[model samples]
Structures are given as C-alpha cells and as structure tokens.
Target: MSKVVLITGASSGIGKSIAIFLTEKGYNVYGTSRNPKNIESFPFKLIALDVLKVDTINDAVNFIIKQEGKLDILINNAGMGITGPIEDTPTDEMRAVFNTNLFGAIDVMKAVLPQMRQQKSGVIVNVTSIAGYMGLPFRGLYSATKGALETITEATSMEVKPFGIKVVCVAPGDFATNIAAGRYHTPVFENSAYKENYQMNLDLMDAHVSEGMDPIEMAKAVHRIIETKNPKIHYKLGGFLEKFSIVLKRILPDRVYEKMLMNHYKL
Candidate 1:
C-alpha cells in the first residue's frame, strides 16, 4: 500500500506545494485548512482543520487514520507571523501568534504521535524558519515561536528515535508565499517609542520574503527528506546567502552578528 501523509496549513504557500509534490510521487496525501471551503480543487483530499483547536486537530487525524489505516508522515507547517516592537506588542496578540505557530503544531503532533509510535515507522517534519536562528528587531515574537518549535523538534527526535519514529525540522530561509498577506501586524501606537524604525523594519522583512526562494524548491527539499530512510534532525533550505547567514551567525561573535543584522535592515 502507498504511504499516507498528512500536512497542516496545506491550503496554500509551501504547504500547498508540498501536498501537490508528494501526491505526484504517489503518496496518499491529505491536506488541511481552517476552512476547507477556501482551498481550491486538488487531486488529494482537503480536510477542514484548525490547528489551534484541539478537537478539529483530532478529527482530522482520526479521519485520515480511518481511511488509510496508517499514517506514514505528518508535516506540521501551520504557522503565523507577528511584526512589531516587542514592548508595544500586546500580550494577547503574542499568545495568539504562539498558539498558531507553536501550540497548534504541538496539538497536531500529539494527535498523530500515538499512531506513529504504534506503527514504529513514521516521520514527523516540522516546518520552521531561518528567522528562528536569530531574533529580528520587529519580528521578535515570530522568531521566538519558531525557535521554540525548533528546540522541541530536537528533543522529540531523540525521544522518538528508539520507537523508529524520526522527527525532523525543515528550516526555510524565506519562501515566496502568501504568508505576508495573512501575517499579523501589531498596532503601532502613535508617538510610540519604536515608531521610527518599526515600519522600515517591517517593510524590509516583507520585501525579503517576497523575493525569497520558490515554494516548489522548498517542497522538493522536503520530498527528498521524506524519501530518506533516516533523515537528519534538521534540514536548512534556502539560497546561498540565506544558508551562509545561518553558518555565519553561528561562527561570528555575538556583537558582530548583531551589527550585521542591524546593518542589513538599515537599523
């Protein structure tokens, strides 16, 4: 029987690309969106799933397992971005962003893990970001969420290895996707302390994402990882600059890296 794969946030962007790519490879793929109605037609199935809601997450997993009898892969790609100064960002807004980016992914992981554990042969890939490697000025909260997920992915990989379940994190630098369209821009209070640089930083970030690597490129990398019998714990996907940036951040002194990032954003 063909392997069954479940992908969250597959309505568009990288998620959509991965779903279509895997299906072409002959995997039985089921994708998800908060509102399935919004998803356009595709060869694979589309299931209504709001990762933030525990019940819907469970329902989606249950439906897939019921139909396929086994799930071979789970890709946690549902995430949201929040942009603003850390001080001015409201607590509720931060929580909502974390809920979608961090907690929501965890919810789906919890739902699918049991079956994966039982099968003793499955893969779980969490879609993280290169932003997770460093804290950007206006995107601090978004960075924190991905960083947290990356840490979790590391821990989960070790814990589940003995059970034959491989947990990996695919960190992409920037993908040309509609993510910016749905991203949350925290309200910048007039005369606020960060007003001067906040908009500039936000605009720069948006422009970088718009010009980032193609979503299909990211999907192809993921497909390669999925085919590997034992993929590495972390896979970084991006162009030369993006990939080198991560390495430079690791090797450079703290102050130097900070200055590099600040200079890049013209801060």
Candidate 2:
C-alpha cells in the first residue's frame, strides 16, 4: 500500500503544492485547511483543521486514522507570516503568530505521535523557512517562530527515534506564493519612527517572493526526505545566496554577520 500522508495548511502555497505532488505520486494524501469547505475543489481530499484549535487538530487526525488505519507521514506545513518593526508590531500579534507557528505545529505533532508510535514507523516533516536560520529586518517575528520550531524538531527527533518515527525540518527560502497576501503586515504609520525603512523593507520582501523559485522545489525536497532511510535533522532549500547566508552566519563573527544582513536589507 502507498504511504498515507497528512499535510496541514494545504489550501494554497507550498502546502498545496506538496499535497498535490504527493497525491500524484500515488501516496494517500489528506490536506488540511482552516476552512476546507471554502475550497470547492482540490486534487486530494481537503479536511477542516485549524492548527490553533486543539479540538480541530485532534478531530482531523482521528478522522484520518479511521480512514487510513495508519498515517505514514505528516507534513506539518501550517504556518502564518508576520512582518513589522519590533517596536511597532503589537505584542498580541506576536503571541498570535507564535501560537500558530510554534505552539500550533507542536499540537499537531502531539496529536500524531501516539498513532505513529503504534505504527512503529513514520515520518514527520516540519516545513520551516530559510529565514529561520537568521533574523531578518521587519520579519523578525516570522523568523523567531520558525527558528523555535527548528529547535523543537531537533528535540522531538531524538525522543521519537526509539519508536522508529522520524522528525525533521525542511526550511524553504522565499517561494512564489500567496503568503504575502496572508501575512499580517503592520501598517506604515506616517509618524512612526520606522515608517520609511519599514515600508521599503516590506516592498523588498514582496518583490523577493514574486521573483522566488517555484513552490514545486519545496514539494520535491519533501518527497525526497520522506523516501530517505535515515533523513538528516534538517534540510534547507533556496537559491545559492540564501543557503550561503546560513553558512556565512556560521563562519562570520556575530557583529560581522549582523552587519552583512543590515547591508543586504539596506538597513
């Protein structure tokens, strides 16, 4: 039998691309969305699953287990984006993003682990971002959330290894997606101190997304990870500069790396 796969936040963007690709590859795929009903058509089954709600997460996971007997893979792709100056961004909004990106992803993993442990074999891929490796101007909250998830993935991987379950992170660079549309962008207040620089960085971010690589690359990477016998703890996919930036951070002094990022963002 083909491996049964579950992907969260599959209504569009990278998650949708992965769901469709896996389905075509003959995997039994179930994609989740906060409002799966809103989407009239999808290549694979779309189920209602809001990551913020534990009830919804449990319900969706249970429903999948009932239908498939076992879930062989989980693509924890559900996440939201936030962008603004640290001072201007609301603390409440920061908590909300953390809830969805870090806590929310953790909840889904908790819901799946029992069943995966029972099966004695499974793969869980947490879809993080290349930004997770380094903080970016205006996108600090988004980076922090993904970075937290990366650390969690490392801890969980070791814990679940005894059960023959694998947990890994796939961090993708900017992809051409509707993520910008869904992102919570703090408005550019005319009197705000960061008004000019914040707005400029926001535009730069959108342009990067528009010119980003296809989401299919992420799909391909996830597919490869699921098939690997002993997958690495982390896998990063992005353009040469994006991937190289991570390396640069490792080799460069703290202030030097910070300066390089400032220069890149024209901060």
Judged by lDDT, which candidate is best? 2
Over 1-267, each residue of candidate 1 has an lDDT whose tens digit, in order, gives 889999999989999999999999999999999888865798889999998889999999999999889999999998888899989988999999999999999889889999999998899999999889889899999999999999999998888889899999999988889899988998767888888789888788788889988999988999999999879988999888778888999899999999998998888
State each candidate's clash count.
0, 0
Cα lDDT, all candidates: 0.91, 0.95
Residues 91-173, candidate 2, lDDT per residue (tens digit)?
A: 99999999999999999999999999999999999999999998899999999999999999999999999999999999999
Q: Candidate 1 — worst ten consecutive residues by lDDT sum?
A: 35-44
lDDT of 1 at 105: 92
Q: Quote the positional error of residue 141 for candidate 1 in Å.
A: 0.6
Q: Give the TM-scores of the predictions, in the order they appear.
A: 0.98, 0.99
RMSD of 2: 0.6
Clashing pairs in 2: none
